[model samples]
Target: MGCMQKCEMSLGFESGSVTSDQISCSNQEQYTGWYSSWMPTKARLNNQGFGCAWLSKFNDQYQWIQIDLREVGVVSGILTQGRCDADEWITKYSVQYRTMETLNWIYYKDQTGNNRVFYGNSDRSSTVQNLLRPPIVARYIRLLPLGWHTRIAMRMDLLMCMNKCT
Candidate 1:
């Protein structure tokens, strides 16, 4: 039987340890409008009307953003923030990881089965945190947005355990 992995509430986010600087998205706005291509950065959290990655209004059709950690590290937690301008945030999302550059992606699922969706956040200003107990080692982390309130927009950061990273 698969062991259920509950979200550990006591584990807090570790700041100033993330090593991901490369970011990529599935859909991005490229018109001469407000949406700029250089909006998405490796920043910890971006506020609305600021430096947030904006995905095309595709309505959660295979939309995602990936972070390259450069090296394998023990990921203890994740922090996600919505556009700070309005009350829009990712409602349901899933996480995937791969240790090597040529390996297949693995879903970070729970014990019962594949945790299809993770309830991210409700408020824009509030940052949603997911703590991993018995942290997993990964070199690449991808944030897949399955559902959102209005449009898909986000800023992500990983709470990396540098000492345990291998």
Candidate 2:
């Protein structure tokens, strides 16, 4: 299939809504139905994997789980968020895209490190943002987890895969 010319795709989980039933991993049932029940000690989807698990000190603080969609075509924008907890940890975030298919991930824009990002430690709430850079033909994307005032881990709200519009 040909890539879409102008498309916006988003891929992510639904905050605290992600239960063991939603995640199809071997250890998925360990957490059951509670969002704060388990921390992602190790997670991998598609062909990417996150090696570290989430850790927090306070149950009141918030955290984030994000992905970088290496330009698949033309991305109009992207967004991410957490659920159950309060929106305090995440302040801002940025999406770094590239056209390379290798594992090496280059910065496609300025590092959006905790500035204008939102951290909602909830179970279903989500946040969306527009990509500053135009979409390019890419094959590698990276998800950077940022923000955390406590020791508790953060969950994903949604992961949108914005492909070119057909």
Candidate 3:
């Protein structure tokens, strides 16, 4: 949670394997299709459209992009990048998730029992990855931006914890 790092395997945000429908966000806030840009589906790792993949409208902590994994999985890390043509990215974030739709959401906590804060990117284009020591297991994962550089614009990929059989 301290270092902005990287991991090898990704849960397919860049490759479009997760599909646009799986990725969504809250608080879009009346900005409907500004030139058909910045759609929730474009929020993928290494994806650059006009400038960035997804440009979040609001500049608040409550704004979040949630990814429904479709089923429960072990998420070990997350990769983040700033806007392609601008200085916009999430600098810090916290995670919340729930296994079932009807159950209450649980925050990924640290050893101190507080919401674990994961550090994000500083400049645009640099991929910063944070490994979850106690990997999260859930069907729904929400990346809530706690801080940012200019705005909460980002391209991301989720890391699924997988073991290779030898």
Candidate 4:
């Protein structure tokens, strides 16, 4: 079964920014949480740190984003919140990963039989099973949106990263 670990790097973001490159990490210590904006441009700022950049392309329509972990490592697991937009509902959601050098994202289910699976359809809360693997390093990670009940904006909450085995 995969274990969960906390991200060692800091997450910094700028409010009202339209691009990821504009999200500065200069004062990495000043960042305490994740930042999301509804700008149509893609920008990310990682002055001295190294990590992946992600943003939800379907803003105001669906809450989703994609990450590329540059390198592969043992991914214990992840915990996220179902914070959809006003009057919106998230019927299904999933987490997927792929090698840093590849373009295809290898789903956890197709990789190993031992994986933690969670489902959130009602209260928007769940803890899926744990996939304990040999630190299979990957480059790309994607968050896919399955269903939307309302036409309002889509939001997510408390998206936490777990243990990263190198």
Candidate 5:
């Protein structure tokens, strides 16, 4: 990844629908009130009060949060922040995406099977980012946390460039 120069245009969460694998609070039968924190706004990290989605109880399996852009767009970069209330953060992660109406996911990787490992935030308050070279044109993006110390948690934002400037 190289330095991300600001483009004249940038697309964000406001441009799409976001969802996650975290259990919601709607189904009372399986819902615990504590896990009711999957709202898209929780990823903004503006304040410290439950500012991130606590996916599940430290399950060793991979957990993910995804965004549907509703249409195809070129994703230029990703910004991530850790859970503000806890020291836990995703130390290693990989990204995969799919284009419009496609069920197949394309892993962001090099010629080698190894995918790019994003070094996540070291502290809860700070932010980390990974800028994609030759931006990926896709409508669906998924963040898979591959490494975790305690549990999987993250606040993410996508940067997309839709138009070119002189």
Candidate 6:
């Protein structure tokens, strides 16, 4: 994630190019905001919405926030941060992706073939970055929290691959 930061292009989250409609989460639309007002759209990096970040009711591994790139493309890295107004944040997570809605999701595995557990932020404001070696070419991406501080809360940014034109 060190050098990957300088090379990858942000995939439009911070700039609003990735519209709110393109973002969704598990257990969404299944209920109303009577439990929480934390929308998936508030997960953008540096978001200052009323919620300030995505606050999940279920902290289990089953919960996730997803992004639809709208088409297949290279995803190089991810940037994560905790909730703006609380001490909640993800401490560890894994990634899953696919090129189409009907396709099966695949975990971004480590060199050893195990699902890669990317370390995330420890505090509420600092950003933690994780690079996908051999980056993924997919239209949809999901970040699943394996462990977190207090509970599962996150604000994030996705980095697009910067390939040299040949």
Could you give candidate 4's per-residue lDDT for residues 23-82 as a string of tens digits?
221222333344334321122222111111223334342344554443454454433333
* lDDT assessment of candidate 3: 0.84
What TM-score against the true fold does each predicted structure earn? 0.75, 0.42, 0.89, 0.43, 0.75, 0.90
lDDT of each: 0.64, 0.37, 0.84, 0.37, 0.63, 0.88
lDDT of 3 by residue, 60-162 (tens): 8778888999999888888988888888888999999999989998999999999999999989888998988878889999989999987888899999866
Q: Over all chains combined, what TM-score does candidate 4 have?
A: 0.43
Off by over 4 Å in 4: 1-36, 39-64, 110-117, 121-136, 151-166
Deviation in Å, model 3, residue 35 alpha carbon:
6.8
Candidate 1 local accuracy as lDDT?
Answer: 0.64
lDDT of 1 by residue, 1-166 (tens): 3444333322221233433246666654442355553344523465335544444445555877777777786777878877666566788788889999899988888877765467787877677878776576888878788878787766667676643222
Prediction 2 TM-score vs. true: 0.42
Q: Identify the runs in model 1 with alpha carbons over 4 angstroms from their true place.
A: 1-21, 28-33, 46-49, 53-57, 164-166
* Tens digits of lDDT, candidate 2, 99-128: 654656454453454323333333223343
Least accurate 10 contiguous residues by lDDT in model 5: 22-31
Report the candidate with higher TM-score, 1 versus 6: 6
Give model 2 RMSD, 1 decimal. Answer: 8.9
Tens digits of lDDT, candidate 5, 103-140: 78778985576787777777766777788876778877
Which of the two candidates, 1 or 4, achieves a greater lDDT against the reference? 1
Q: Show the lowest summed lDDT stretch of 10 residues, model 4.
A: 40-49
**Model 3: per-residue Cα lDDT at residue 152:** 84
What is the alpha-carbon lDDT of model 4 when measured against the actual structure?
A: 0.37
Quote the positional error of residue 108 for candidate 1 in Å.
0.6
